[model samples]
Target: MTDTPSDPLKTTPLHARHLAHGARMVPFGGWDMPVEYSGITDEHMAVRTRVGLFDVSHMGQLELAGPDALAAVQHVSSNDASRLKVGQIHYSALMSPEGTFVDDLLVYRMADEHFLLVVNAGNIPADFDYIRSQVAGFADVDLVDSSARYALVALQGPAAARVLQPLTGADLSGLKYYWFTHGEVAGIRGMISRTGYTGEDGFEIFVPPADADRLWLALLEAGAGEGIVPAGLGARDTLRLEAGMRLHGNDIDRGTTPVEADLSWIVGWHKDAFLGREVVLRQREEGTARRLVGFEMVDRGIARHGYPVLVDAAPVGIVTSGTQTPYLKKAIGMAYVPTGAAEPGQTISIDVRGRPLRATVVPLPFYKRSRS
Candidate 1:
């Protein structure tokens, strides 16, 4: 198997547009991509208040189709696949045999016998290999890695619907959350999913790589009067953090189980056996050793990833993801602490740059916007 570092870096079809918009490019998950445009705070607020566009072509998009497609996905994921209908989508976690996370992904049931799995960019090759290996015995199933041929653009915020409705013939109003429909944008056939990572009403459009630049430029031109800004990964991070969303590598890893990461809700225990059923069931019955929780810094310091969490002056846990929230104007973070110390309002100390910063456990979703 090839290591992540040894693999050549990938570039999206919209790479030139990002550079034109003055995006600060950085290497992420073996991809040369933009980290920020304008500024993280400004771009983050634009999405919350108006609308913002994101080029997320770095994410992996794979198609699973065949007679045994449903069964294959059901066996690989913790979510119940039997409930999904055509044009519906569900958020689920892919578990290792030991019940730890392989990655968290969105599964879109495009048809009765076809599905699309949107996975994190860094985990694409590993995820593809793992899924392929598991489905070797399922002769009727076929898995195709389509990440290279498509580009995904996300139009997000309160005004997102208005900007996208005029571009497509599809009746987007009837396309409820977690649902999708096939549509045409600028004469290019595409799939539109009413899903987003940031907490907002939005649509994720999957179009051919050849039409990527055209659609991106058209969206900008259409939404130019509506305060739409081109956002980058830096702003995306702050937005998801404030919305209490999880980042794969930071908030979850191979060493952490879903139950311990406060993601047990994604596990469908009532369904038939999956890859990690025994371990998850055991964790559920006996309870997890640690739990993920949200906290807000009371002292003046930014709590960052890998910072030590202290209770009673003793190290107990470590912060996984954190940032100075652009929306809240405060330092907030998520960490894995002992269940006993995960209560909301509990006092904890985070060791920040050699100084202990006081913080209080807070309920998730530090920022909430009115649904459009």
Candidate 2:
């Protein structure tokens, strides 16, 4: 998930804490971050069975306010923001007029005239600038990059709420998925959202930078009895991959449209005017030439990003994300392929270092938590 270190990297509020704990630091999206602590497999299992904590302070947050916020948001995002009630959040994308993702983001409706957009770490500047330029047409909308106000962390896994319930006065049990509440976490006032990249049930807490260390420590201590472990970017990637979550630069990019990415559900087809609506409409009706789908190796090989995909001995598409999942214990991946070859039970070939390996197209979310 990290690019080779070249430019000086930015540090999060909890960078020192990570170093103190012997986390393997790497440069990811211009930020110095922990790739792993104890180990990726151990951390991944901790989240699958018990609980895991993650320092996600590098994520960017944008706050939109003013009377025309809903209208402005609708114009820039793919989702129908007007449907989001107060305290609710929805997954959407900031897109160009051509339907390619500028960034996939979560839109939070905090109030009638205020909202929040949580974007990926790497695309902050571009995402913010694009949103600003698109929404500038609205008569009354104010956009502010508010990433400086919060140091974010996620308490994810089966024991997430159990671990976090004691720290906050807010009723964790009452907060449904994709909803958030304002409360004090370990005595530090912040916003807590019941959303996460990991497929497991979790909570992402946003607190001011100054109080991050204390909050982090308090959580670790509180969840110690529940076998909570500190996870890093490595585990995060594998977990999200298993959960069928997209990593920006990998799974989807400027060349891929939401329709081709199989995220057309986020498009508000009923909306009068929104960025990229026409292109999305045309794709949905006319059908995209290619679509993103999940697959698993039928042979002894692991798929990685940018690996070539072959359909009937001909190169079709390429792998977007893949890994030998810690929990599932199998090599699984996602890729864009011809629509005819994207369905489950379809067999395909992966060019694993020039050796063609057989693979089977499978339904997405290679892993899902048992609800019972």
Candidate 3:
């Protein structure tokens, strides 16, 4: 659940389409988004077994271009932007000087001197300000916030390719994962990417806002026979949780560093000093006091965020993310605990509603799809 902002709720381009599908609207990142349609469980299952469409237009899109675009991106982001080839996408983190997450984002290399950054909805203003500050030192880079101009729709599931292939001339099979190509999808020119947060084979199509509803309706009509359905934030959260994909505000935040969050892999230690690299290097050399771990409930109760985690009956940390996953059918959660106690198979107790429930540390990504 997102905190209600002081500003009035913003609606996505597909707001009317969501309502027409009988969606349950809720506040998310200051936007009135669909939490569920049909039902969370049903939508979750659809994405896992078949296909599901999601209106993720609330995500922010920032465009960077000019001779110094590469230098500008490499400065604000932890990952090496120089490593990304054109038409490729890389997951990266933007951090504060103190080494805490500003937001996790996707860096899309559209051209040698052009890039598109997709950042979390809630952090749009902050992220934009942060990036602008970094780019100010460079003379040649030009930045543009094109978030409102585009609508992002994620078509995710095992059958996603089959459902989407016929509508676009782009060779869906030829497009490798983590790559995108500009093409006409459903007769609308857009950037189609083989990326998704649901841990399924899928595509994230970025289309003009005016063409959003038309492309949405077209995809639905074409995919109806393939069991495609519209999914909402509720199912999205559960799906990502099951995939062990961290949610920005929950699993990671400004209070947590990449090292403590077990995401040091995203930091390009070899690259020239990016923001937060010094602190990250120190953490790497000294090691973190606490580490994030995945766990499953050994007891009956469902673990929720902020619930205290106990080690030998003493509070060690609190749960960051937890839920009863529809596809996994298990109570799973992620938490930050002392590094010494972060090993798999370590028995811990979670304080759920003042009662301690037993749980065990387990490997992340409670569920993995069969590649074959």
Candidate 4:
């Protein structure tokens, strides 16, 4: 029996509309959210072939303002803030003093003295508090939580550009990757970022909470003929998994360092000092004990989280995330294994429900869409 609660789940600004459109609601990260509208496979395919909309209001938004805001951010974040130009965005990780990951977030430079940080839902409070405490002596820097006051919607797929072109006045084509533009959509102003988690061409729109419903309706209506469907968390997971994207708690935790997770690209090794600089530097010099890698099941059985990995029939690591790919029609997953077993084409076995399933380590980002 599933452990669903009797009480209705917390809804987003677009909750009523999601219900009206036949979304299957499920509890996720303390919020009641849609797992899918039509079907996970169908919705997943739609985003790959055409377009799909996702209500990601559960994400947290934070604002930093003041003369010392940039310096404060530089001290706390792992990314090199000096490279960020106005209207530019960067994917970075926040590390604890011990060098463990706090959360992976997107940092947007709105202006010289103002910036925005988009963080994961589960880590909002902890991230906010850690950042607040680190800003000591950095006077004039004010932190504000704007998560509840705003709505975030992601439109992703091959046809995303065409569908969104009619509704916004900004030149969608001009926005480069990791760049954003401020514009009005159906008379409502917001910022549109050309970034997504689905490994496809897409945009994430930040709008006022009160205008969320209208914007949702307009996009659906406009994309009706283009086969844009509303996707949910279920499809989002599979899509991101196939794309080799990492989830905060699943693929990485407080005990995992960015270097071990293969996310060292997000860390600024050249920077003078940051929260986890010493630990990261040590890891760089000494190498990591374990590393995250992709694996495909060569035998039957689905490998779910917490499953054991075996080397010579002896347990060596644990699975973090897994899914049956609708596109590839195969079992795939990610896990943290000893560095010696982390190479591509390495033969390994995962214990799935008491059975050993044959699998091979492979390169990340199992799927790549045509960017052009």
Candidate 5:
């Protein structure tokens, strides 16, 4: 029997709406979230080809405001928050003292002294406490966990703006990628951001918890003719993976650093000081022993997480994330292999259930959406 998340699962405000839509619920990140609706492939293609919606309310939100809020944010975040203009958002990582990832998150500059942090669900409590601890020396830095008060929904794909533009007063076209504005979406006041995890032209709508279902159902009705389907975590993961986005716990965690994960772009080397600056700087100078890279199967086999990756019939590294990409129609995965074998076009082998399957290192993102 499949284990449902009824006993200790934290359901979102749209939990009933998911059930009403015949969604398959599962335990994810300490919450009862939709794993699939129509199907993973269908939903994945819907977002790639047309449009799709994802209820990402399980993500945690932290509100940081006060005199030293900027300092507090800069202390723990790997990116340069000092450069963020009001209403702009940037992808960043929360690093530990050892230069390893605490959690990868998005930093939203709401105002001069106010910032909002969108973090992964499972690391909320730890993130909150860690952030609080970081700001202990800074006076007047207030950390509030406002995750329960808001519901987040993502409308993604090429038709995202087309479907969402009519319902909101915000100039959807004017809202550039990684920027947000306070506007009414479907007559409900909230923050509408032109950001998404699907690596497409999309928007993440943040609204009051009580108004979640209304906006969800309304969006569905509005996009019924546009091939907009309710997507779940299954499609979400594949889409992000195809886009080369890293999962917090899988591709990056306490054991991995930005250097090894090929995420050096996020680190602000110019910044004076941060949690893991010293180690990251050293790693940048000396070079990482292993690096993350993308690969596709040469033989017929699917590589899963924790699968042994070998270069010369010996275990060199392990697979972090792997999947049969629905859109790519091939078995692709990301793994941290030795620096020598991390180059593109380098052939390697993945042990799939004791069988060595030949694979080749490709570029980071297996697929990129065309501008056309």
Candidate 6:
């Protein structure tokens, strides 16, 4: 869900295509990317109701091969990678010694002794270097930064499978959530994973750079029935926020530990050892002083990032991510607060531009799709 963007100097294969679609471009992470097409609200609703495509090629990728791949993955990741069977993916965090995030990532078990890591684009170089150093002492593990070798696009929403089924030979129905398969898509060989940041049913396709435009157009045409549109960073951010997905720069960062961020489910606590295992375990058993919590504005105000969160008119924490979601049409946000005050139904104050605004802590995932 950390779609803050990356590779500031590079553009994905679909850059020109985005321009042609009359997109408003913005600088994200390190790349020039579309902030919106049509408009943020329009694009956001399109994804919520029908389908939307996103150019996510700026994300970083790493390959770990050899007999020690699983060991290497287990060492750097919070999730238990050994439990992943072939074609399966698990959400994980690359942890530091203190159990803070190096980066949140996806661990794809491509094979028994081979794996692919999808990491944030801005942290690509840092992530690769860090992982390589961590696994340097391991026997027979080869780490390679293969970021430029592939292009990625996410076809997301309820109508995603309906749209993608016509473009790929792979059985979209058979690919369970977080699973992937190497298949032919729009006549090109690619890997399709049934995962998305929007909390919708969708697929992220990894294809060669040369085939990006082809695949992009093919999907647009295939999904025309569903009013498919090209969504950009603006919609992506709001969508993920509604889904309660953590943004790397805003919601979770080097300063925040996973447990404090309310993401302990990604940790494989039984793994005996890992970077930051000690800190994480301690926090797991004994809770942190402050915890991330979700809230909706009780008054008319937007509780933006960096705003002070107050208790009894005194500053205690800060807002990490907030927005007026298009689909939900309500102002919701997340913040870190004293653990005692983190429970839902509790009331808090957000310092909204010099004015203290009242808000109520609410359950996470402000929106959930009906899966009937």
- Whole-model Cα lDDT per candidate? 0.90, 0.92, 0.93, 0.90, 0.93, 0.92
Q: What digit string (tens of lDDT, one per residue) describes model 1 on residues 253-297?
A: 888888888888788889878888999999999998789999999
What TM-scores do the predictions have? 0.97, 0.98, 0.98, 0.96, 0.98, 0.97
Q: What is the lDDT for 283 in model 3?
A: 98
**Per-residue lDDT of 246 in model 4:** 93
User: Native-vs-model 5 lDDT?
Assistant: 0.93
lDDT of prediction 2: 0.92
Question: Per-residue lDDT for 1-372 in model 6, tens only?
Answer: 323444235689999999999999987767789999899999899999999999999898999999999899999999999899999999999999878999999999999999999998778988988998999989999999999999999999999999999888899899999999999888989999999989788999999999999999999999999999999999999999999999897888888898999999899989978999999899989889999999999999898999999999999999999999999999999999999899999999999999999999998989989985
Worst 10 residues of 6 by lDDT: 1-10
4 or 5, greater by TM-score: 5
lDDT of 2 at 125: 81
Between prediction 2 and prediction 4, which has the larger TM-score? 2
214-243 in candidate 2: lDDT tens per residue?
999999999999999899999999999999
Per-residue lDDT of candidate 3, residues 69-185 (tens digit): 999999888888899999999998888888988899999999999999999998888788889987799999999999999999999999999988999999999999999998998
Candidate 1 overall Cα lDDT vs. reference?
A: 0.90
lDDT score at residue 69, model 1, on the 0-100 scale:
96
lDDT at 88 for candidate 5?
A: 96
In model 1, the worst 10-residue window by lDDT is 1-10
Worst 10 residues of 2 by lDDT: 1-10
Show the lowest summed lDDT stretch of 10 residues, model 5.
Answer: 1-10
Q: Candidate 5 at 117: error in angstroms?
A: 0.5
Which ranges in model 3 have alpha carbons more than 4 Å from their true place?
A: 1-6
lDDT of 3 at 90: 91
lDDT of 6 at 22: 92
How many residue-pair clashes does candidate 4 contain?
0
Off by over 4 Å in 6: 1-8
